[model samples]
Target: MCSGGFAKCLGITLIPLAVVCVLCNILLFFPGGKVVESDHITDEVWYSGGIFGSGVLMIFPALVFLGLKNNDCCGCCGNESCGRRFAMLSSILFATVGLVGAGYSVIVSAVAIDHGPKCLALEDGKSVWTYPFNTNGYLTDSTMWSKCTEPVGVVSWHLALFSVILIMGLIQIALCAVQVINGLLGALCGDCCGCCGGVSMFSYALDS
Candidate 1:
């Protein structure tokens, strides 16, 4: 029962949420990878999609932990099943990392749209607006990439809304893992829990 329930939860929840977060990050950061010459995606902070995608990646191990944990509980009759504990702990740990990384992505994107120097914050806390190129000719020179004063064209609020939706879905997906955990515990403890494999009906997988 534990194994069945865990697989159901995973098929329905965790994997799907991670998928969305990864996709949204790709769209937000790359945006066709054109590197808006004017503003927005300055070289100062290539921090959009990458960070969020990494956060999404963190969930993979979590699903594994959850599945093994769930299965052991169901098969063992409450006899020292280690899988449940491992899965619960891993889910919480990885999900927390995902949340933190998501927050950073949001802050960086918001700051980039705010002001140029403010964009400096995402540059690992350095002034990307320096007057001259340091060495690598990317944007160090003030007259070159630094001289870019044009504003990044207004991005669609719809896109931002999509990002929000993606993150929310991510949270829902993480929350769904708890259901698997609960099911495992109930099975071992001889309580009640439901099979949730079909929960994926409402969840969409992240972009490829």
Candidate 2:
């Protein structure tokens, strides 16, 4: 099938998602880590954010290197450069995707963290509720642990923070894999194009 408008639409939608996913991953890790582990969690956050954002979000702009370009002309000028549109769209999609991860992290933390002590503590004037952090690092309640009477089942903000960090870490690793693919694509395609078809073209914008 002919690839023109489809690439155009994809360039617009997909590139932004790529960018957003990077930010989303970072947001998810923060509240949970800060509330639970405090300073202890910083290293993990920095590590994961760097891996995902740099490994993934950083390279996401390269997506434009792969796809087609926009055929439609915009603005008052009737200039037609289809490849240029693809580059922009791929960049937008990658950036947007990078942010989606961050967005999910933020929203999930907002809700899940409500159960956390820092957030719950704000209610105040009641019992000081403590949630049990698991080896998995998920926050539940300590009562859940004592019932099992199992060894090595300690729970605390540290565990909870670690859990979120772990989740984000796993995601960052995955993003790294994706970035490798994009990186390869970038290398194969390079940044050279009569118009620089997909998203990688936007890299110039960032450099500027």
Best-fitting candidate, scored by TM-score: 1
Model 1 steric clash total: 7
CA lDDT, candidate 1, residue 166: 45
lDDT of 1: 0.43
Models 1 onward score TM values of 0.44, 0.31
The models' CA-based lDDT, in order, is 0.43, 0.40
User: Per-residue lDDT of 26-130 in model 2, one digit per residue for the tens?
Assistant: 553454434334432323344444335333543443344234332233511543443344343344455455545444443443344443322222123443333
- In the order shown, the candidates' Cα RMSDs to the true structure are 11.8, 13.3
Worst 10 residues of 2 by lDDT: 146-155
TM-score of 1: 0.44
